[model samples]
Target: MIRVALVGNAGIGSQDHQNSMYRPAFERHPRFELVDTAEEAEVLSIAVPLAERGTAVADAIRAGKHVLADKPLAATLAEATEIERLAAAHGVVVVPAHHQRFGAALRSAIAAVRAGRVGLPWNVQCDFVVAGGDPAPTGELVNFGLYPVDVLRALLGLEVHRVHATGTPDLVTLLLDHEHGVTSTVVCGRVPALRDVPPGGLAVHRYRISGSHGVLAVDARKPALQVRTTDTFGPVWTGPGTVDVLLDVLAAGIAAGRAALGPHDAVQAQRVIEAAQRSMAVGQPVAIGQPVETGE
Candidate 1:
């Protein structure tokens, strides 16, 4: 069996570990075994606090285990870089848990875009808003906000060249310049009024891609997709149930002897996030893929 260990007890891991460990989906999988500690596993999943992710992932790598970390990679670019370097040196795979990457709704939307159903996507709009909760932690972006940013990059197959951002404790807006001249605007926030939607209720993370042909909208909240044409607009059906697809991807990567997110890709994403932070700090657009002067 492919031994796997979960490193965090929060959010999905708390529920997933309990449910999947007991359910046939994971328990009966002929190629897997979920262990309680990294010490007994060939692969580790780090789903802890943002600050601890890098250290935990690095430790697992040092111990010769493949690692799958939840998104945003690490709290800062530096830590992410270190983890990447160490993982590479040790020849361990480090895959970020970008579960949305494997979503059928999202995959379908991207496929439609690529098939020219939406033409050449020029502008993109995404909203990841949810009700209730305190402002995100100081100096940190919201958990789900990163979803759109990363998704835009993946769908477009481009890197963010520039970023302009503004926000308050509870809300954030980001304007991104993509490689192909595509512009993306992402608005994310947690409003107290939305709290009534239920815990994990209607956490609306959706995107609208506008191209020369039409518009394609995908909503993760209801797990649906909408395509707008010149004469008609309608919803497209997708698979049922919320699958932890990333975990399966992680498992497959480990079994195949590969890292989910290579060092370079992880670093690049972190750099984009860091640029957004800098843009917010200086109240100006920040150019990505460039060196910034540091006092230290």
Candidate 2:
């Protein structure tokens, strides 16, 4: 059996090893075991706060354990870089738990895009909106808005070239330019009231990728995807539960002695996020994919 230790005790951590997210799958699988601490496992899944990720991962690596760290790897690029360097020095794999990358609907959409079914993606629009929740400890942008941005980046297989961001406590808007000439606008917010049918429910994340030939839209809240063509719209494609898929991937990567999200890739994503924050602060466009001064 592949021994796994869950590092946090709150929120996601509470459900980490219990299979609360995917009880059936965990119950059926005989190769995985969830333990309470890193001392008892060969793999560690760190689902703690962003500020704590680097330390948690470093500890696991120092113990000769592989890690599956939750996304936004660290609160800042410097911390992420340090984590990457440490993991490399120890020869341990550190995968980011970017669950959206494993979503079936997203996979199907990317396949269609790659197959020329969409005819060259030019513009992408995405939104992740939710109802009110308690104030996030990490603030709104990092707490909820990061998901759509991360998913968009992963689906496009393009690095962010620049970003223009603006936001209030309840809403955040980002216009991102990608390396492949693809431009995207992402909106994330928590609106006060829910519409009748609900414009998009709380916890709802959606995206529309438009190309020369057609458009594909994914409604992640319903956990379904739809492809629209000039002639007709296709059927909805359902996806697996997000948490379960993430855990399974983590387990598999650990068993194989590798990380699903490489250190460099995770750091790159963190840089983009930091750039977005800078854009929000300066009220101007920020260029990405280039070196910026980061405090070590």
lDDT tens readout by residue for model 1, 17-104: 3243223334555567788877898877666776677777778888998876666677777777787778768877787755555567
Error of 2 at 149 (Å): 1.9
**lDDT over C-alpha atoms for residue 77 of model 2:** 75
RMSD of 2: 6.0
Clashing pairs in 2: 130-202
Candidate 1 Cα outliers beyond 4 Å, as residue runs: 10-31, 133-135, 139-142, 193-196, 224-243, 259-265, 291-296
Clash count, one per candidate: 2, 1
Global lDDT of each model? 0.68, 0.69
Model 2 over residues 197-254: C-alpha lDDT tens digits?
Answer: 2323355667899999998887665554555768654434466666567667666666
- Among residues 3 or more apart in sequence or in different chains, the pairs in candidate 1 whose N, CA or C atoms overlap within 3 Å are 93-259, 131-194
> What C-alpha RMSD separates each model from the true structure?
6.2, 6.0
Angstrom error of the Cα, residue 254, model 1: value is: 1.7
